[model samples]
Target: MPTVRLPVPSGDVWARTDYETLPDDLPVRVSLVHGNLVLNARRRPVHQRIARRLATCIEDAAPDAWQVDMDVDVLLDDDELEPSEIAPDIVVYSAEHDLYERPIPADLVALVVEVVSPSTKRKDRRIQPTLYAEAQIRHYWRVETDQTAPAFAIYTYELDDATGEYVATGVHHDRLTTTVPFDLDVELKTVREP
Candidate 1:
């Protein structure tokens, strides 16, 4: 039998590949969200800074846990018949497990944060939150960026354990402090400004 080596796809083609064929360390980050592949686009400086600041805040707040960025995926379910995966901007997972390999379920995640970009405003505001809530994620935060004031609108929500759903617990115009995991305070203004 003759051996045939399949040519690897690059750039955008890599993003379009089926989940099973994606190679390790693909040039662009790819995520399977709701059966659709999301390609990582170049981010603006402000967007990058905000994500970094939020990660730092979470780390300081929960010194014992692990905090990560979009590079990691959160697999919501393991049922072979139905697979769900999402990559949020920042995710705080249990410190006890190795998170680099693949998506871990929503139960393992302590918190998820999404920093909005102009291109992803709608998806971030409407679609993504619902998905996270459906996955039974405990805490979800949305960081809205204002171009004029260059400020961030931080909104926090907590899951209703009885109903297994998320409820808007608080909305912060400038900052946020949480009691879960650890005592953490985030200055929304500092994160938004360049």
Candidate 2:
């Protein structure tokens, strides 16, 4: 991936307005985290492979009413100055919504998956899950990849409506089978294959 310049915001914090108004042709990739504009680095090939594979599997199994999208921002808040907008590795949302919409609202999102990377381990494991739960997204999956091989550990969580938090539903190693949002069964190791 080639480098591209990130836009500079006038205020100390990068507001939602700044991110929303970026040039259409800008080559950079970024995500707004708690009011900060986080410039994303190019992902490792293994990371990309896993994300693409999981997305494909999810889309194949998705029902007619649902759609799968990758690296798209899901709006968790609308505050102009301190909004929280996160772009998960993969998102499963309602098909009724327009795909071109700038940010997919949290309400329409049924599931968000994060393929953990060294740089994003903390955020993916802790911060992101918290934000998704707070937004009431029904399901979440954290994929832990072993750089040495195709081995993976997939952890699935379902929102506990009463506590406004996620409760562990399953911890998968060889296969990921889930029955929320829709039924899905993915052979976890296939994610690393060419």
Candidate 3:
């Protein structure tokens, strides 16, 4: 006997509800970007592994700091408490604030990292980075899997408070070493490997 398949909804069919109403067990990763629901499937093995390794490196470097996943929302409000948000792959938030909270402001974030997946490459490279910068996020890093060069392209962004925006300070093609908040060094090649 032949089996029938049901039709699935197309083009962002997820329910539009308050982010707080989202169930804890929801299978997909969800975030609100300008009132638009952005739902994504679970990360591929490569992406997950990279995120984990990068998290470890940052933690090792900044022991007192907090590193969180894209599940946590970062709010960017100009006047009212607008929850225009984005969940980055990895975020290092300030140690001064309440780490366990929802919708942490972009100003409180120290670093935001996005691992480029083939499916979301355009969004990751173009849209997300630009939005993060506009939100005045201090540091933004773009990690790309370099099969040809065997290293990741780590780009660091610095925020100019006077302009209320972020600027690309440096693009490190080699292993990255930093002393911005604290002394730390990490080899991009090591993190890029399988």
Candidate 4:
């Protein structure tokens, strides 16, 4: 038999693959959305504030059986991001889930949240929701920061059983008060960007 070598590219073909090049101390965010490289925006204080605040609020409001986590991997597929196996800003799962294992299963996740940024709007507003819905996660939340105001626009979605798509459950601009998975009362306007 003749020896042959496949002509493979030099760099990683996936966004998550390229994400490994980032330095550990770097504050940048990255997501591999369906074999495409979606480089996240420079870290904005407002973005982080929303994500952090929501995590705390959800944890406080959720039942003891539900666990809310931040920046944890939720894998639906081993490689591709179409059936997007990527991380959400925060994921709420059950206490019985095996946290010890890497790449937490999406079925165990009840909710997935994405804090919208200028750079991540398409993914957060559209792409990720489809993926989350396809994964059959019950809830999805998006927090959008205003350009001029010290406030956030939040949207809550519930998966539609018939279509397996997200249905808008609620939309909040002044506050994040809700009673879906559990009661949540977060003052969106007061969340400091600093």
Candidate 5:
């Protein structure tokens, strides 16, 4: 993964009035979470394949009100642009929200998915899920990649309101079939194939 840091400060780029600005054509995925500016590294080939395929499948099955997008920012706070932006790999958001001027709020998001890679495995498995849960995003999915084969690990989670956390609904090694947000059917092998 690639990361570029601004010269302003350790934990923020949006706080200082005199902070240097990002380039007009920033290329990499960037986020501000918990006062830290995070730039996701360039994605591996396999990671891209899985993320796109999964997004396609889900979009096909999702309801008309839901739209699927990749590498889009979700603002943790509806009011501010700093210290809480998270760019999930795939976000299923309701079309009802007028998000043209703002990042999609958690309530408008039906599901957020992250395809795990070597560099992001820990954060994908731990940090992101917790954040999504607390945001009450309702559904979270983590896809674990398998480099040697076309089969991947896919886990589905539902928010447990009592605990403010995600509870595993199922872990699928070959296929994921669910109807939480909408009817979904995804094959791990086909999604991972070259």
Candidate 6:
């Protein structure tokens, strides 16, 4: 097998349209951040496990008007020159959206979750939260996996309209309970089950 190099558009910065033209079969996950192309290797098994199980839990508790999906792009800024698009581990969005749409608009998103991994620690904890907050997404949850007794910890945040930033609302170690994205409760350990 040979390495496939991404075809870069001739421009000062990569735009949303440029990103859309990239081959879907590319081996890595690519995102447009600050007008640059950022590549991330495939997620680890534990990362995928946490995302999948947690998404199921959220979907079960979500209201009839909202839906849950994993590893789908959310378009934060649709600027022609320097658009920003990112895929979260899990996204809770309006059911009214078209089913065939790619890069779901940020405004349509109710909540976004990221299961932190070694590869995504800085982006998940710092960069992504800022982007989601700036886009005014209502809720953000970061799941930090641990090798210790707790297994995982979920840090929840809500958008602060006054400052346009996320304010940490709660941190749950064993169980997660929240009412903002609709009343929901789940045992964090379920994400680690075999």
Highest lDDT among the candidates is held by which one? 6
Cα lDDT tens digits, model 2, 115-162, are: 998888888899989989988999999988885326668889999989
Tens-place lDDT per residue, model 1, 8-41, is 5444332323465766656556566655566666
Q: What is candidate 3's lDDT per residue for 1-194, written digit by digit as tens?
A: 35423223233432223555666666667666655567776788888888888877887787576554544677754322234667788888877667677677888887888888777778877888777877777777878776313556877767787875667767776578887645779887778778
How many collisions per candidate?
A: 1, 0, 0, 1, 2, 0
Instruction: Look at candidate 1 and tell me the lDDT of residue 98.
Output: 70
Ranking by lDDT: 6, 2, 5, 4, 1, 3
| lDDT digits (tens) for residues 36-131 of candidate 6 | 899987998878988999999999999899999999999998877778899999999999988798989999999999988877888999999999
Task: List, residue by residue over 12-42, the lDDT tens digit for candidate 4.
Answer: 4553444444444544555555655455567
Better of 1 and 4 by lDDT: 4
Query: Which tens-of-lDDT digit does each residue in 90-166 have in candidate 5?
Result: 99998897756356778789899999888897789999888788789999999877853365788899999899899
Highest-TM-score candidate: 6
The local lDDT score (0 to 100) that residue 112 gets in candidate 5 is 97
Please give the CA lDDT of all the candidate structures.
Answer: 0.71, 0.86, 0.70, 0.74, 0.78, 0.89
Measured against the true structure, the TM-scores of the candidates, in listed sequence, are 0.79, 0.89, 0.78, 0.77, 0.84, 0.95
Which residues of candidate 6, in runs, are more than 4 Å off?
Answer: 147-151
Q: Give the runs in model 5 whose Cα sits over 4 Å from its true position.
A: 1-21, 78-82, 148-151
Please tell me which model should have the higher lDDT, number 2 or number 3. Answer: 2
Over 4 Å off, model 2: 1-6, 10-12, 24-28, 148-151
Q: Please give the distance, in angstroms, between residue 29's alpha carbon in candidate 6 and its true position after superposition.
A: 0.6
- For residue 110, model 3's alpha carbon misses the true position, in angstroms, by 1.2
